[model samples]
Target chain A: MIKKILILSIVLSTFMVAKTPKEIYEKNCVECHATLPSSLEKMFMSYIKTYSGERDTKIAIKTFLKKPDLDTSVMSEVFLDKFGVKKPTKLNDKELDSAIEYYFNQYKIKGRLN
Target chain B: MLVSRSKDINLFRQSEKVSLIRFLVLYTILVASLLLLISIFYYQSQEKLMYAQYTKLLNTYANSQIKKLKNLHHYFPQQTRYPRSTKFKSAIYDSEESRIFSLLEKEPQYFDNKIYRTDGKIHLVHTLDTYYLGAKYLIIEVDEDRTWLENTLKYILILGAIAFVILSIFGVFFVKLFLKPMRDAILLLDDFIKDTTHELNTPISAILNNIEMIDTSQMSEKNKKRLTRIDIASKSVSLLYQDLTYFALGHKMQKKDEEIDIKALILNRMEYFFAIGNSKNIEFILNLEEVYLFIDKAKITRVIDNLVSNAIKYNKRNGTITIDLTPMGFSVKDSGIGIPKDKIESMFDRYSRFNNTEGGFGIGLHLVKSIVVEYGFAIKVQSSLDVGTQIYVDFRSKGYTL
Candidate 1:
């Protein structure tokens, strides 16, 4: 039992290391979205078109992630029916906010034109 | 003659000054209002030209932005950034006029006009033929350069000043041109009078001397009466001749100041006018105090003579003339055809006549006023029409003595 307790402590300590926002987003959001037909950049474009600003777009995405529902989904009804509604995220407010921020920076329509 | 000519020229200068001022005021108002109207139109057109130039440049920027937006839409997965430029800032709006994104210093408050200026920056809104990244309206903003406006205003001010100066010079020339005929007519009248007065002096003196040599004591009553009329007529002509001579040439004469008893002078002038007064049945009433004055004797005598002559000439038949002399001054009040109230102010003006019925030139009062002014004496006239007139010469200034 003492050996089992020491092994548990070692695993928890390894999990305790803080991840960057980009890493956090990739580990949580990209992993599941990789199976979806629409790309993550395409979803971000729909949010940007509908929400139209950095703050509103991030809030809308964060809200949808925290409580996944058909009514709150930015995806079309056909797309949702094919892929099924996403389950509610287990991430807390701070982690969800950081992930949304990283997602917005990666795909936002700024500074890319030649 | 030279002195009188100079005096006439001085009078001409005074009238010219008055007319010049009047012309300058009207001319300045006309030119200034015209300049202001021109400036307003110039500024508005300049502003329109500036806006047109800037709108053309901004439209180019907007087209480039549209091109960039199209490229981003074609490579949506690869393009990670939006386009920006240091030359200008921009924003986009959807078909419903909601802002998509803005990098502008100030948010646009209106979208109706294609181009407008606000907060010192120019904004141009361009509509895209296709929705480039859901942007139906692309708004380009740039700093509004004001160097053109500054240069325009500077040119307007400099040109306006030059125009005003040139117009003012023309105004002076116009005034001189307008006054030429009037000055020539006045000088002609002056020369005519001088020549006429110069010719009359000898004949008037000769007539007076011949009339004084006549003796009517031994003649019949009818002859004596006729001779007395001739003497009186000759004396009147002589007095008129003296006044004309003085009016034309008095300024050139040297002043001979002396202390004279004014009482004796008034009494002597009354005796001289006795025949003329008798012809009109006018009575003389004297209230003389022994007053003396230090002045040019000929000038003072002319003053007294003109006052007494005018009194007799305007007096009604059986009317009375009252002569009052004191230390302060003297007044000659006549029960005559008194001057009208409106005509009283101009009574002392040369050749101004209110009564054409009186047989004399109208230079009597003007000559009196000239001498009075030269001696720094104040003269006043009080009159009521159809009743009487009183002319007072106050001598308490430079001419008065004990």
Candidate 2:
């Protein structure tokens, strides 16, 4: 009876530990983009505004998130001097896409609702 | 010192009996380790190659698209048919050259193409690499399906696994087949030892019997002495025959463990040895305790015949041979050229001999030892080099009950 109970507990623990795709995204990158809602137009606008003067935003963001780099951040020297350089968020491609869409809808076009 | 070939040959790390098993186990481990190492290397290198190929194909698509896009701008700069072109599922056009194109071939909707916002639509584009040139990025408006490189890697791994398993099974079978001849040779050698011991009984009997029938009364004194020596040679042959027979065929002998009068059995064996003893001028001093033992008469006869013949053959001329039989056991002592100190231990070993002068194949004491051992009796031999030799056979105390 004790052996059966132990085996059941082990199997239950594994299921509990398993993460869904949404949870994986939330844990890895939700800190930065969790407040944003999902929208493709808003996402594109947010990307433009976020890296206003950046040379290569798509390639830079993809490479940077996979392997972070402070030297390539699109934030201006004046913004970084005030806020201190924002840390680049780490995420898998799938999770990053979800977060990216969320940021676009929330910050980029939140004013367009009116 | 005995030189053993088994000790000298250290080709393998174990004895002959277990060498093949050990070799099989080692070979299995080696093959498994090699397979594991190769699989790991192949997995790592193949994964890298696949990724590189994917990147290369994607790059090829991007480069070809850029080349065509440049040519189109050169030829028809104002053509709004760019979006309708089949080169890209969805394409964004910049005023000068900036464009993001998505390939239509993908299983699930994941990626999108977008031209970044810049001052006056500055035509800045980036190229990517992939394993398949036909498909790179997918467009949201177009849906296509064909992933060739991923399917290729999957097939390669599956086929490699099947080939490895089949080859490993064949290797195990071949190893077993290769070891079969050596195993058969050892079995044949054991059979040869048994057969050779069985073939020695016939001629040995004929020689001993002819010597017994010799009459020395008509011969001269020198000839009579030679006859006596011949008699000793014959008894030695008889002893050897008894030992070999006891070793090979003793176990199959019928046993009748009746109450045997030990004194009478000793006296009968003494009579058998008298002819050889007479030729040697050896005197017999019988000291019988009239004891009884429980044993088969035929086996007891073999044991007594071997011991008495030994005493007579090694006895000096005119020497006294004594036989003392009791419930405890029997003892035969002779004043003759006694066994060498070094040879006493091996006296019970088959074909172990100390004296070259005495005619003996050296199987007598070996036979005596075997009979005593079979009946749970103990025999001890004691000798002084020039004095005499004494052999004592002690049947265990339980022999008295029967």
Candidate 3:
């Protein structure tokens, strides 16, 4: 009976997982950044768009986000002035990269915007 | 003063007393020296023991205080207060005076089995030497605690003094006790001399009288020879009697320091000994200087009598006796059996004799030695066995010019 219940749970959880990049971002992110402010979000969207067009989009976005220098930072001076410093995203390097990938594919001009 | 007077009695004044005293003196010196050394060592050791005990007491006090402070530290590591006990007063320090602690409510004193100045309360502080956790952080002061040592020393000194007094008493007692036998011996000897001299007095006179009364005209040649032998025997006894008297009383002879004609005295004594000298067929050769000396007459006569008679007695048959008297000294030389070298030193000891054949009781040289020493004179003997003996009496040549 325990084996049959475990098999049922594994199969049900696989269907709930995001199958594409858009779904990955929708499922994992959106809570902190979506409501933060438009200016900050727009800056973050630009960095995603710029790095997402590259052939090695995962590597480029992952390195940039993990240790963001002032030159590579996506946040504007206005937003930084309002909030004196941005808290570091707690997601690991690979997780943040994957999330960024999912966000880029969902919002890309070519992809579905919803 | 009375001791000095008694000490002044010479052995010559009474020879028996002198010998007894000499023996006692030697014994006392030896015993006193031994006791004095032993007593000093004993007293010093006692004094040292007292000091050692005093030091031990101080150490005990320090150890007890240290132990208490360690306990206090265990209970109250940061407590700056310490309880004051009647038994001790203490001071504590911690970390170079970063913290100083005391446990005395007031000064502490232990006197006459009572504690004083205790403040009737406890004092508290916290100080410690963290560098050495075992250091004495507390020192307890006991007023006049050192009195234990001082009293010990005082009692030791008193004991030493008592011991010294006791030993001194013993020394005196033993000295007198040890001399008792010698004293008794002297008294017995004196009684014997008194009785024997009295007994000899009668016989000597009787022999002389009988010799003189014998009619030699009617007797034969054999009878004359017998009479001469009796005469010689009488003279020998007379000489013996004179010597015994000299030995017994001669030391007390006064130093009259009279102007003495040395040459005349020698001739007179030589004449007295001529008969004995002739009996031994001994010839005399005299070379006398007209010298005078300042000395006791009786002592010089005794010295002369001993030397001349000994020469005659020990002379060879028809041997020569030479008497040479000068301003410097006089020598009596005899051609007879010479003294053995080993016996020469003891020759002057009373009754020390080398010749068993000689009729002397051996007091002759001993008497000569005593008289010579009394007058600050020196006598040297030179001898070879079966050859001869020479006695040189070196008078104070410079002092005896008179």
Candidate 4:
């Protein structure tokens, strides 16, 4: 029991120190989104098409993640019917901000156009 | 004859210079406005052609972007990076006119027009049929190449200068052409006057000499009055002839300056006009102070004769003629048909006649003015209609000795 508690404490400390925005996004968002019909980039493009700019797109995505709502989702009703609304995210504000920033940077269309 | 014609032309040129300048100004403005209009049209056409070429090229760029986006959507669905190029900057807008992505230096404010320029950069907006990457409007921007504009402006400047030079040459030719008839008429009138003056000289001298020889001492009062009238008429003709001769040839005459007693000169001129003044029952009141001046004798005589003659000619019957001769200047005040205030300013202009009832040419005061101006003297006139006229010649500038 003492060895198990020491090992658990070490793992918790390691997670606290080692979790970057990219790691957090990949662990929390990608784990579930990877199984969806649309890729994470496709959903981001949907957000971009609806919300347009970086700040609005990020706020929109964060709002939907914080409180899963069908009215605010950029996805179509057909897609929503196939795979119901997503669950609200459990990340705190600071963590959520960093994760959203990482997600925006990952799929943003700026600088990639030839 | 050729010399006289050339002299007449020179005189005419001097008098008509103001007219020529007016014509040149009007002509230059007309031609400049025409050139400006042509330049504007040329610039607009050139800009339109350049824009058409740019629109075609930018449309192709937009088509290429659409193709790339389509390929990305179909084959590279998981591709994390968007396509890009270094040739130009671009932006994509969704169906709702919201920007999906942009690499442009400036965001476009208007989308109604397909292409436009702003901040020295050209932007071309092309609509896409397919919503590749959800982009409904593609805006392509590039730095506007201004070499064509610079070249067009240079061409316009060079052409405009050449056209102006050509037009000025034509304008001068047209002005001369337009004035040719007037010049010919003036020359003809001048020759007629010269001939008339030459013919009248001998007869006038003969009449004056013959009249002086006639014995009026033994004649009847009526005969004596007739003789005096003939004498007065002949002298009037003689004075007119002298004025015409001077007008025709005064510029070519040599100056003979001498010191003369102005008081004596006035007295002598007054004697000459005494009979004419007497015929009108005009009284002469002389207020002469001894004054002397060094000037051309003939020119000064003309000035004095004109002033005295005008006083007599314009004076009312039984009117007073006041002659004032001072060290500085002289004045001739007459109770005559006074000049209107508006006419006084132009009274010294050649052939400017105010009283048509007066029997004399209008050259008297104009000749007086010419001689006064030549001697750097000033003339002042004060007259009121139906009251009287007074003319003063200020000779202080000529430094008259007392």
Best by the DockQ measure: 4
Each model's lDDT: 0.83, 0.58, 0.64, 0.84
lDDT of 4 by residue, B109-173 (tens): 77878898888889998877655665767899999999889999999999989998999899989
| Candidate 2 lDDT tens digits, A18-107 | 555566545665544444343333334434434421233354456656665446554446644665544565455766766544543343
Residues B1-402 of candidate 3 have per-residue lDDT tens digits of 000111232323355557556765775666566656766676567546644554465456656666555554443324324545576566543222322344444542332211222333222222233312222234444443345446656765686567667766775687567667766666577657645655676788788788889879999998888778778878789777767766654544445789999899998877668877878889999999999988878778878888888888888999999999988898999999989999899999999888889778898888889878877788899999999999999987347657
Per-candidate total of colliding backbone pairs: 6, 14, 10, 7
Better of 1 and 3 by TM-score: 1
Worst 10 residues of 4 chain A by lDDT: A105-114
Model 1 C-alpha lDDT per residue in residues B71-143, reported as the tens digit of each score: 8776775764678998999988766677766788978877788888888899998877766565667899999
Model 3: per-residue Cα lDDT at residue B99: 20
Superposed model 4: Cα runs more than 4 Å off: A1-114, B1-14, B72-80, B94-97, B217-220, B384-387
Considering only N, C-alpha and C atoms within 3 Å, which residue pairs clash in candidate 1?
A110-B81, A110-B82, A111-B81, A111-B82, A112-B81, A112-B82
- Per-model chain B TM-scores are 0.81, 0.49, 0.66, 0.90
- Using TM-score as the measure, which candidate wins? 4
